[model samples]
Target: MSGEFDFTGQTAIVTGASKGLGRAYALWLATRGCAVVVSNRPAGDGSSSAQAVVEEIVAKGGRAVAHDGPVQTAEAAAAMVEIAATHFGAPDIFISNAGIQAFRPFSTVTLEEMRELLDINLWGCIVGLKAVWPAMVDKGYGRIVLTGSSAGLWGQKQSADYAASKGAMVGLARSVAIDVPKGTDIRVNVIAPAAYTPLSMGSIDPKWADYASPDHVAPVVGWLSSPLCQSSGGIYHAGAGNVRRAQILEGPVHRLAEGDIDTVMHALDRQPEWTSSFASGAEIMPEMVKASGS
Candidate 1:
């Protein structure tokens, strides 16, 4: 099945393509016949880690270029996209995979660190999305895959800033899925990836050593960024050679008469099952209103 998916004329911009999963994605895209633009912060005399990936791709008879610059800024992101367009034509796929992590307790997290994480993780994706949106809209086709984290979806200790940034990405993807120009063919989605990369090796416990590698994450990412992906406005969890969709479910809620503080309190104290009823968002609101009698 994988062999059938070819990207002969497509171009992709993969951020954070210096190493890890981003590098893996760039190489994979190239092998699949897509001309790739690799972007990362300037390093090694203003050359980026993406440069190495570009070299590897070229060695394998694939087309690739590296863009070493800050991707957090709208201007820089625009320039990256422009580079792809001017060189290979308008990008058909975008993977906003650049991210950073600062582990600290919520109270101990500094404003500086918080801002840095948000800038790199959240704002970076926003900039990349905006940069490619118009061209994709005009062409009536596009694919975007935003990198999210499991920490963003579930609570984690000492990951306040990281979780917050990732959580914002989920919402960003969801909103964009709904906001794309009506009838436009653009598809936007998020991936909560659990893979062994430089970022995870030291952080994740060794006992779970069988999880997927960064290379494993690329196939799903590549698929999501392909014109072949028909689904949009969705979240997928991919790792350990497994891929599945994830949905935000709501629990059953209870309603109480207005001004009935006692009933509300009683319900709160006795409604264990209601608290456990994990349903959808649409189910929660009406239940809450009924419980509040408002």
Candidate 2:
């Protein structure tokens, strides 16, 4: 069993905190003594969902503030960070969970529709990272979690736009984690979660909500956001009380021979079941040399 973790002096910014997974993450961190900035878009009624989350946290004697705005724009992301700084301190934890989805055939997915999804899912994370990265860099300590999806990990039918937005996040998180400065405790990771949020539960049976609830996935995200976690560029899948680590691997290069191109084509086309994954980009040349049999 792991020892207890604490976030007594930490501050967090959680996007889409008005409901679903984002709300759960805000509450999870706030209850652990982490001051939280609950960010989300305003409701159709013009009331902020974040306000209610902030009130709930305050009722429990936890510190929280509400920032109501779309996370897609740099201005809105900056506002969230500014609110965090004003209310608690520099945000050390950021969960870019604000996203939207619409299931449709890939052929039917128009450019305008894809643009909207990318603006929120992909560009939202980009702006959020840009907003708080400077503070984390200067402090040399931070935890960043990007919300990804299994659609990106594998693939899903009739989810072209959603998958595209999420796949971009997985790539973005990996790149950011790899580029973090040396000697800094700052880490960035992605989580591909399968939670039954409003998007799923509203259309399905209510009983299954207990089995795939957003609450079930919140703790996994908390662990990723904890200072105790040493992982960067880690990809995780969490939901329904099951947590897993995901990896991207590669097979050795198949050099083609000119002497008997057709004879060797079949061998080159065959994929190895067991192949090593890259430790870093720098390993490519060495691996290539080794594969060359030189």
Candidate 3:
């Protein structure tokens, strides 16, 4: 992979940056010449875990500030953006990386748990975007990266709430990309990351831990949150020093003459192949036409 992007004079806000993946992202951005806001919820002693991350970056002669709060709140989100603007400048990047997961089966999961998951995982991204979007629009440039999970892409047995939240993030990123005004440089994308951080490892499982370090995932995130990112509304899978694009592909269209069981059965019997996977809906139809021999 080519590391060929400049982040000079840029500012980045990374949520849940106390440790693990978020901390890695913040530090990597700092090394690339971007001032960073390290944000996370305060710890039990009323001190912020993000404070340590800020200290580490500053020790390395990098610019960083810590903002501690429940980022799901609009007030907290606005405060983070204001800190970024007041301390550094208008933030050029926003990494909506804060989230929580409940590991319970669908039938056993409580409504309260579901609500909390949706609030932290899905609503947090919306709140962050609301805070930074106007500044980005006015500046005519921004890179927004929403963190996703494999659970959302392929559901896991005991993560129904987590899966639902992540699935929402994917849709949110796509719609946000479409909503940006024309001729603007704002870009939004989602990453379904697979890293063995504190969140991934409840206990130290040595088998995957070495291979799935958070550092391995930071490179793809840096590229996605940089000016050189070529694609928006795209979902990338990153971890273990490997990266790949994930997309929703469609099979050949079976345009039926009538909505009948017999016609549907015939179409199913044909079992048309998917000629290609698309990054956006706009690319789907033309490829389907070619695949269908229409």
Candidate 4:
């Protein structure tokens, strides 16, 4: 029933928090009265980069801890959740934001490259979800935000692997929303952010820098991770301080008859008008579960 992002006494875990969007998310949560776990793989400087973020949060009178490890591994993800519970409490929010991107032509992409992308971008999310879902279920409440990308929704040249990995996240969010048991309070959503982060800021034109700042995307994420967000299985586009839901719609279903080429052509011509958008998994699954009595 709460429609505000007030997270007092709650805990949050944000991966890839050494910099960029993850850092913004961690800081935002901390400012809103939540204890935070900031995680990132160590840098070549042999320093725990996540610690620096934690330190900054602590300096601002917020509670935070750091975990430095490769988030693509399930063991590492589990360890993060354990640390969160040990230090603070069972996390109320889980942001699966750790990912990697490699741009190479589809024809020239190596198996190694694809494997790496899938492992870090897609599998990392699965690991995070698996690690924290049971805890959320036990508490009967949770907010899970999986990161997606524009490339994933619409194909991008030289980014086949990246697109595939991100696209899988969208599907994962939708399926999880549908499959979770009835009466569960868990909310799962995906954000396809067009932000200027270390991952791609260098390639962005200077003129658009202000509009694409990572800060602009953090609020949308915060909203989704709060009790304010009622919608699940949704894909949102957030950038330049604007937010909107991205829906997957289909043309009206038309019955097909066994027929020759002429009949097929006529059916095509008579296809229902594409006026209304399709319902999301959140909108479609409740009735299904009710019918099945599961």
Q: Score every model by TM-score.
A: 0.85, 0.87, 0.87, 0.86
C-alpha displacement of 182 in model 3, angstroms? 1.3
Q: Single out the weakest 10-residue window by summed lDDT for candidate 1.
A: 273-282
lDDT of 3 by residue, 7-121 (tens): 7799999998998889999999998789999999999899888999999999988899999999899999999999999999988999989988657878888898889888998
Clashes of each: 5, 0, 0, 0
| Better candidate by TM-score, 1 or 2 | 2
Candidate 1's C-alpha runs over 4 A off are 205-211, 258-294
RMSD of each: 8.5, 9.3, 8.0, 9.3
- Candidate 1, residues 1-294: lDDT per residue as tens digits? 248779999899999988888998998889989999999988867656678888999999999988988879999899998899988999889999999886688887889888988899888989889999888998889999998876777656788888788878788988888988888888899987776677876754454444446776788898898867988868887766667776776555657664487867666543222221112211322333244344
lDDT of 2 by residue, 1-294 (tens): 124768889999999888889989999888889999999989999888789999999999899999999889999999988999998999999999999878778888899988998899899989999999999999999999998877775666677777778888778987888889998999899987767787655433565566667888899999999977898888887776777787776666666654477766666544332121212211222333254343
Tell me the deviation in Å of residue 155 in model 4: 0.9
Q: Distance (Å) between predicted and true CA of 199, model 2?
A: 2.4
lDDT of 4 at 191: 90
| Clashing residue pairs, backbone N/CA/C < 3 A, model 2 | none
lDDT of 4 by residue, 1-294 (tens): 123667888999999999989999999999888899998988998789899899999999889999888888988999999999999999899999999886698898899889988998988889889999989988988999999976787676688888888888888999998877678788999998776688975555555556567888899999999988887999987776767787776554445565776776566544233221111221222333243353
